[model samples]
Structure formats: C-alpha cells, structure tokens
Target chain A: MRSRTEKTLIYALLIAGTVTFLFPLWWMVAVSLKTPEAAQAATVRGGIASLVPTDPQWHNYPDALMQMGSVRWTGFLDALANSVVVTILATAGTALSSSLVGMAFARMRFRGSRPMFLVMLGTMMLPAQVTMIPLFILFRNLGWIDTFLPLVVPAFFGNAFFIFMYRQFIAQIPEALLEAARLDGQGWFGIWWRVILPLTRPVTAITAVFTFIFTWNDFLAPLIYLQSDDQATLSVALNSFRNQYGGITKVNLLMAASLTTMVPCILLFLAAQKQFIEGLGKGAVKG
Target chain B: MATIELNCVSKTYTGDVRAVREATLAFRDGEFIVLVGPSGCGKSTLLRMIAGLEAISGGTVAIGGRVVNELPPKDRDVAMVFQNYALYPHMTVEKNMAFGLLRRRKHGGISGLLFHRAERRAELAAIDRKVLDTARTLGIEPLLARLPRALSGGQRQRVALGRALVREPQVFLFDEPLSNLDARLRIEMRAEIRELHRRTKASMVYVTHDQEEAMTLADRMVVMKFGVVQQFGTPGECYARPANRFVAGFVGTPVMNFIEGRVDGGAFVAADMRVTLPAARWPRMPAGPATLGVRPDQLRVLYRADAGASSTAADGASVAATVRSIERLGDRMDVAVMIGGTRMTARIENDDRLVEGGSVLVHIGLGAAHLFASGEDGARLGDAHDAG
Candidate 1:
C-alpha cells in the first residue's frame, strides 16, 4: 500500500502529465476562437496571453469552412466525406483480410506455412517509404492514380503487423473448439465464418479501429495519389492550409479547421473503444 | 452404433517422434472402451485418431467395419467431448447444441432439399427438438437460453455433452472430459457418463490419465506407456493380473509395493529378510533377479508377539518390522512399515493395535503376490499371469 503522502504525490504527477498532454488540444480550441490579428499579436508578445485568446472570433469556423470551398482547395465537407469513405473501406478491408490470413497462419497446417509466416513477419521491418516509389509506379501503370483505388485497394491484401496481431489473438482460442466445430460437420470456411470469426470479434474491432485511425491520419499517400482537390482527404487539405504558396495564412482559421477535422476521430474512438474492447471479452472466459 | 477397429495404427511426427505406435484395438458395437495411461502415453492421441481429428501415420482405422483413414472428422460419424468442454462461448447452449445438426441437415429429408419454405421450417423445428431433448436428458434445459459463460463448471460440461449427444453419431469420443472438474464433481460426472453410456448404444472411446476413471468407466481398458499399448482387457483382468511391472504399479491405488529380491531354494530372499512363495501357485521358480509385487490391501498386519497365534497362509511369509507411519482414512488405514531395509505399506481396517514407531509383523501371502523381472518393463510371471 502507498502512504498518504505518496499517493498525493503520485496523483499530482499524473495530473501534471495529463495537463501536459492536453495542452495542445486546449491551445487548438482557444486559438480557433481568436481573431487572426490577435493570434499574431500574441505570438509576437510571447507571454502566457499567447496561450489564450484576447478577443474571441466566434465566426472563424464558418469563415474557414467557407474559404475551404475556393478553387484553390476542396471544401471541409468534401475532405470529410473522402476521409470517411477511405477510412470505412480501408478498415473493413483490413479487418476481413487480416483476420482471414491470421487465422490461416495460426490454425491451418500446410507445407511452407512456417517459412511463409516468417517472411510475412520480415516484411514488417521495412518502412512504407522503401516501397513508396514502386507502389506509385505500379499504381500509375494500372491507371489508379487520382482515384481511391490507390488508397483502398492495398488494404484488402492484408497488413503484416495486423495479420501478426490477429494470429496471436486467434492462436489463444482452444484447438478443441475448432475440432469440435469440424466434428459437427463444418468445413474449413464454415468453421472460420461461424466459429473463428465470432470468437475473434475483439481483435477484428481493434484492427478496424487502428486501420480507421491510420487511414484518416495518412497524409503522404493522399497527397501523392490524389491529384484533384475534389478527391483530397482531410490530412492533405490540412497540409495545404499552411504550406500553400509557401506562406502560413489565417492561423486562426487553420486552428479552427484542424480542431473540426479531429472531432470525428476522437468521438469515434471514445464511442467504440468500450464496446470493442470490453463488451465481447467476458464470453472468452471459460467456466 | 458402430464397432470401431484400429489395425496396428500409429502416429509419427517430424523428427521420427512417435506419439502412438502400432495400436490395434477392436470395440464391439455399443461397448464403452477406455484408453488409460500417464501423460504423453498416447491415449488421447489414439482417441483423436478414432475421432478423425488426427491423421494416421500408419495402418487402418475402421468404423462399422468400413475403413475411414481418408475421411475427415466431419464425415467420420463420430462426436467428441473435449477435456476443456469446448463450448462456443459466443452462443447460447441451444445454439451450441444445434450448430452441428443445422449444418448437416438440408431441409427435413432427402425428398425436401429442393422444396419450399415449409420444409425448411420443419427442418429447423426438428433441429430445435433434438437440441431441446438432448438438453433435457443432460439436465441442462434451464441453461439452454444462457451463454456458456453464464454456466457453472458442471453446467458447461453438461452442455458440451449435450452438443455431442444431439448429433447422434455412431461413435462418441471423450478425451478426458471430466478431468477439469473438482474431485466430487469428477466422480459425479463419471457416474453420469457411465449412466449415459448405458442408456445409449453408441460405442464410447474415452481417454483419461486417471486409472480409477479408466477402471470404473471401461468395459475393456487399454493400458498404454511411452506410446505403446501394454495391455487390453477387462478392468478386473488388468487389475488382478497386469501384463508388466509398469501396469501393476500404475493400475492400483496406494501403488503396488515392489521389493527387490531373489528366489533361493524356492524361497524369496532380500538382504536379511526372506519370504516364502506359494509352491502350489508357483510350482516352479524361474531363476533370475526377481521383484515381488504386493498390493497394500494384500498385506496383513500382526502383532510381533501374536504372530504365531494367527492362521497365516501356508505358502505366505512373515517378517518382523517397525511401524513407520499410519495414515487413517476413516474406516481404513494405511500403515507403513520397514522390513529390513525395504519399506512396505499395509492397508487394513483402523485398529488400536498399531501405533507409530511400534513393532509389528507384516505378512505377505505369496499366493496373491506377483513375480516379475527387476526392471521398469519386466514381464509378469508366476500365478498372477493373465487368467484369460
């Protein structure tokens, strides 16, 4: 047991850590409400006043959203729609393919399975940058550039890390359960669909959530593949906010746009984390 | 019900590690056969082979007089209840029991496969009836609507049994199904399993490491060691006349006592102690390093001073020993005594005559003793040979 003083000290440290982590979020909301001139003035003054707004400009969100519709970039709603489309497709694709490959690797036995799994794990060592050029060329040859194909098609092929995670998760399910299913007249696909899939819901949800976050936050792929502004995702649009024509403009609107863009992800994670992680977990415990 | 037969079946893994070797067993239709041994003794492997969950490395497996080596578990006409009670946790008990039946049935009958909605509904209702009836028979009717996680250990076990029973297969394979339960629950489930076996004609091939479980449940038990089938016979035959030293030591409770000695001039002698062998049962003494095995129940305790007054078996030997310890088990007690340099146990009714650190006479009736070679795999000799 911790002493009273020790407990107080630990709590104080934790509160400090939380505040440090949340400071950027607070800064984003505060700056989003400030006038552009006040933001610049506070930046020049360099004090605690810079951490907060002097006079709030409540119309910056509407103004930023309206400016997002100009010929220079896709509007906020367009980017949001693109993000949703890519994230949902990518998440579903990844969940299905990853769990299938993982279950095959973990449960089914065949020649070269060991070497194949090791090679799959080996691919996790390489960063996306290593394959970026080749993938771009491949997409170009297939006439997939400036389309969602480059963004969503690769997810269906299965991700190595997600497959490995799913494999580890599915391996913990008892072999007897699978055998029992087989004895009950289920073929391999039937067992996977009826038995393995339901047992691995928690892992599938986790993989989907991760894929959703990764596709939403991904900037390079969309920036490189999506040539037209209408097809641009939020990350590419956000990048265009500061680096367009080599000058950061309308810092207040940028903050407002950034805050609004992150809202769906935060709300999604908060809404889904509990049901995915906790709801189906109690069934796994054997009596 | 099917008569299952294995003809010199074996399982060899990579690196030439054999899990089961040349096991040949034949079960009559509706016979409850048990495969009994210690861990890694290939009992469960043999059971799995019969269930078609494992690939046969050698020989043929026949169910209902038809070879099924190439068949998968789904087509093998067998149902297995696992040691862990492999219930589908995400489903209700009714669904778990009905899942297999639902998958196998197409409409209600062969004539209804292409028929309309009424046939499908009737088929589903039939499945529901089978699941509910099996649940009722297993006394798990109330738990049908509940998930496996909501059940107690025994309840989950019953549900697992029900799932297998609902399928109504030709053979029922149980791989240590009751081992996970507590002692009392294990005994109760054992009895229930026995009763269920009696009520059904399906041949049951059960695998368990517990010798008692094997003995009590088997119509004929197969004793295995190091992946080899050592003996196969009725439980009474295996217990009374084991085939080898390992079987004798493994089959009985409190363990059979082995005293290393040799027969000299038709009498057994070890260090300063000597025991008389029953000449009527032995007739002739084979000359070799001998180990005499006696069950704890076979040894009678006598007071050192009153040893001459008792009517000891004519062919038996009496030895003076110091009482080492006494473990009282309600109506009976296990008394450990050291005769010369060797220690032996005597199980008798609890009596006031014996005390710790006291002196007593241990009597061994050679008529009931087993003689074997002096090693781990020694062959049984003398009167205790297999009577059949």
Candidate 2:
C-alpha cells in the first residue's frame, strides 16, 4: 500500500510537470484558433477569454498566411522556402561531413593522431560568440553578406561537438570489423563507407535531427546575415507579424505563423525520437 | 594454394615492448597451419602480419615466393575471418559475402563505365552467382536475404566463412573464429572447419589460444609463449616428444606433471622422495639439477606396493603418497596424490581401493619421462628412449 501511494504521487507530479511544460504550446494553438478581438484581448491584461476560443476562426490560417508576403519584402512563403533549403542542406552537410571526420579520428592510426584528436576536441571549448565576428568578416570578404552560404556552408566543414560524438561512437565499434574489411580488399575510404558508416545509422539519425532543428530554429544567424526580406528565414520573418509600435496587429495571425514554424521541428523530433534514444546505448553492443 | 615463409619476423611497439620476437616459420602449400598460444602470446599478431592487415616491423613475409612487406591487405589477396564474425551488420548475407568481389572489380575506367555498361552488368551478375555458390557450399543459401542480426551463432560463423570463401583469395587467415561458441557447438564447428579446409584446398593460417582446438585442427602447429615460438611441429610430435618443458606442459590435457628435483647418480631426488631409474631407461647418467616431466598416462597410482609389482611398469619404481583427490571419469579417473609434500596427478582406471587420505604407491614410468635442464625456460636434456 505504501509503494502504491508513492507510485501515485510520483505519477501525479510527472503529470503536473508535463502539463506545465506543454501549456505554452496549448496557448499557441488556442490563440491561433481565436477570433481577432479575442486574440487582441489575450494580449491585454490576463483575460480568461483567451484560454479557449468561443467562436473558432478557421480562416485565420489562410488570412495569416496571406499577410506573410507583401510588395516591400518577400514574406512568409519565401521565408518558409528559405528555411527548408537551409535546413535540408545544412543537415546533410553536417551529417555526412561530421561522420567522415569522426570516422578518420576514431579508426585511422597516424602519427600525432591522439594529439590531433585532442586539439579537435579543444576547439569545442571555444564559444561560438568568440568566432562569430571573425566568421562574419570572413564571409563578407567572400562576397557572402546577404547569401545563405554564410549559414549553410559552415556546416560542411563539420561541427566540433558532433565530430567528437561521432568519433567516440565509432571508436567503440569492434576493431576486428575494420580489420576484416581491410583483409577483404577494402581500402580505408571503402571500409569507412561500407562498414563503419553502415553501423552508424542510429547516430546518424540523431545528428541529422539535431542539425535540422538547430538550422530551422536559428534566429540570430539569419537575422544578422539575411539582409533582404525575400531571403529571410521563417524564424526572422516571424517578427514581421507585429506592427511598428511593437504591438501585434493580428495576434491570431502571429500565433498561427509561429505555430507553423515550430511544426517541422516537432515532427522531426517525433520522427527521430526512437533513434535518438537507441543511439545512446545501441552502438555499444550491437553488431 | 600458397606457401607462406616467415623469416625472423618480429613486432615491437613503442617503449621497446616486444609483442612477437624473431619468429621463423614456413608453411607448405595447402597446409592448415595453426598458431596456438595463451593470451598475449602474439599468435593473432603474427596471423595479421601475414594477411597484411598489420605492418611488418622486421624481417619479411613471402607468400608464393612474392614478398608482401610493403603491400596493403587488399593488394595481398588474402581474406580473414575474425573472432566476432565481423559481418557488415547492416548488409544482408548476400551483400556481405559479395562485398569483397564488388570492391575489387574494375570497369575499365570512368569512360568505360559509362560506355560499356554491359560489361559491368555481367560482372555484377557473375559476382551474384559466386556469392550464391559460396553460400550454398556453406549451406547458408536460404539466409542470403537475411541480415547478420537474424542468424544464429553457428549460422553467422558459416556466413563469415562464406564471406571469405566467396572472394577465393590466395590465402585464408582465421583469428580464433570458433572461440565464441558453446562447447558442443565449438566441437561441431571444429569438425566443419576441418571439412571446409579439405574441400577448399586453400592454405589457411588459423590462430587460437585453446590447445585442444589447435591440436585437432592443425596440420602442423606453432606453439608460442612470451612473444617467442616455443616449438613448431605436428600435434603428435609436440605431444610425444616436446622440445622443452613448456611445450610438454602446454599441449596436453590435465597438464603434464613436473617434479622439480635433481638427477643424482641414476635416480631423480627432491626433498624426501626418490624414484629409482631403470638401467635401460638411464644407464650412463650425467645430470646435476633437472626437472622431471611425466605424462599422466605414463604414471600408475597403485593401491598396494607389493601388488603393484606385477601390474605396473617393469623395473619397479614406486613412491609412497597420500591420495589428495580422485576425480572420476567413469572408466578412467584422475588421482591426485601427495608424494612427500609434492603433489602429482596420475590418470589410471577407477580402482575400488583408492580413497582420499589413504596412502598408495605411485609407480614412476621412467621409460616415458622427459628430463629437462634445471630452472624455467630450460632445454630438454634427453628423452628416455634416446638417452640410453
């Protein structure tokens, strides 16, 4: 009876924490479905009417989507396209390049390899803030001031943290597998492509998902680099929903646009959640 | 089939730690040579060096009269089966077995690959046929579509073999492939491997730490210890006429009994025990300190000294000892006895009179004993058959 009561209390606390965490998402959906007056009223001092929509405005989605694009700037549609391109390319670049570099550091034996790996890991200690201005200067010199190359191209060079993760993950795979591949007529690159890369599916999924979410939701980089409104990502364009006075013009429209921006990240996390958890412990024992 | 000749090969890591010292060996064509030793004995390292998976630190390895010191593993035309059955985990059995052939195939060049696609298609079909044939030979054809994770241990072992067989490389290197299986499966796979060796007619270099596995599989085995080859001979020769005390003790079951004592005049004596050597076994003895080794089968543990005279070895060499333990094996038993504070075991028939704490007479079969020079790593002095 004591254990049962403890389990019930534990479950009750978990449910409370879960509801607290999910409240904003529920509010976002509620505001997106509310009428314009109701959404505007929600912006005012704590109004209970904003909690639930009395009369749901289903047309608010299309009305808000139409407000995204205008003559002065390419609006929401263009921002969505820009985010898609950047996210997909950056995720691909991060996954492939990071795993390749990781495989080299993990499996190959060269002179000073240990020190090289240490130096690579040491790069992770440097904050992105330290390199942001230098990178901006470099990208400006490369004629990349308003282009997506500033955001997408750096991913191809590999992330230090992701490479460190891949290196550690690849290191635990049996040495005999690589040796067997070598004896079976596989060159170093061939062995990595054929054997090492194949066993890293779970890790690859986790890396790809994280890269997708980071590239999609990134606001500061896009705001800094994307000069034209046409090339702006969804994260930066989400700011356009408000008027010049910093008060939302259509509170429901802003909620709708913001909710749309978060959908891909949520779906991606849902899709990769299984692989993310499996990747933590699966590589240690599986073939 | 290829003949492998290793001339004084040695491996030394940094800080002057030697893993394999100057080792000279020669394997005949189509011979199954097994390198057997305890763990950390450098047997697997030697096998890897032969397969070109490891760089040779010193000397040269010549396969079929061609030196492979500078060649990479792919260029050396050798295949290895690892201990863990290192199958490409994501690939099906068919793709795993065909991987080597796929990598080694050439399509003339980039332009030929585009212009002559028919040739590449034919090559792919031929590789598929080869994979199927090898899988059928190993009786894993039905599992061609299944991933390695779906197979049983024995089936995975067969797939590992099939992967090597499909390549048809010049030489086969196996690094303790059956070490992971259970006892009964190990025995079953041992026979199957011997059968596979016979059918393939390929020269195989097998490495194992298990002495029994090495003895049963090897045409001629290389016994190693402490990075050095202790002895390299046929299993019969290693068992019957061991080159030194270590080789004698390592290659037998229940272990060979060693009595560290001195041979004074004609008999072996240590502490309070002395066994009179027969004149025929040791006539002209010139020995100081020596270690005597006797096979368990050669010694007889008699219940009574008077009754032992008629049944035991001729020349009547017997010592009084208390029975420490008797392990029964139905028809035969392992009787461990304490002879004057020294413990020795003798394999004899399960006699009814033997009991723990009871004293018995242990007859020393000097005619079949091995006399070695004193101290560890000692040279064998002489055998009973040849010394007299």
Instruction: Judging by TM-score against the true structure, name the best candidate.
Output: 2
Give per-residue CA lDDT, model 1, range B1-388, as digits (tens). Answer: 9999899999999999999999888899999999999999999989998888889999999999999999999999999999999998889999999988988877645556556668788889999988888888988999889998888889989998999899999999999999889999999999999999999867999999999999999999999998999999999988888888999999989888888988777677776567667666666887668889999998888876754332334667777778999999999999998877888989998888888988778887665678888888798875624432
State the TM-score of candidate 1 restricted to chain B: 0.94
Grade the docking of candidate 2: medium
Enumerate residue pairs that collide in model 2: A68-A76
lDDT of 2 by residue, B1-388 (tens): 8999999999988899898999999999999999999899999989989988777899999999899999988888888898999998888999989988988777735755898799888888999999998888888999999999999999999999999988898899999999899999999999988998999889999999999999999999999998899999999989888888888889988788888999887777776567666667667678689888888888788777453232223454677778999899999999998877778889998798889988778877866688788777677776456543
Clashing residue pairs, candidate 1? none
Q: In model 2, which regions exceed 4 Å deviation? A: A1-4, A35-37, A72-74, A244-247, A280-283, B108-113, B266-285, B305-316, B383-388
List fnat per candidate, in order: 0.87, 0.80
Model 2: what TM-score? 0.92
DockQ of 1: 0.62
lDDT of 2 at B260: 90
List of chain A TM-scores, every candidate? 0.91, 0.93
Q: In model 2, what lDDT does residue B226 have? A: 87
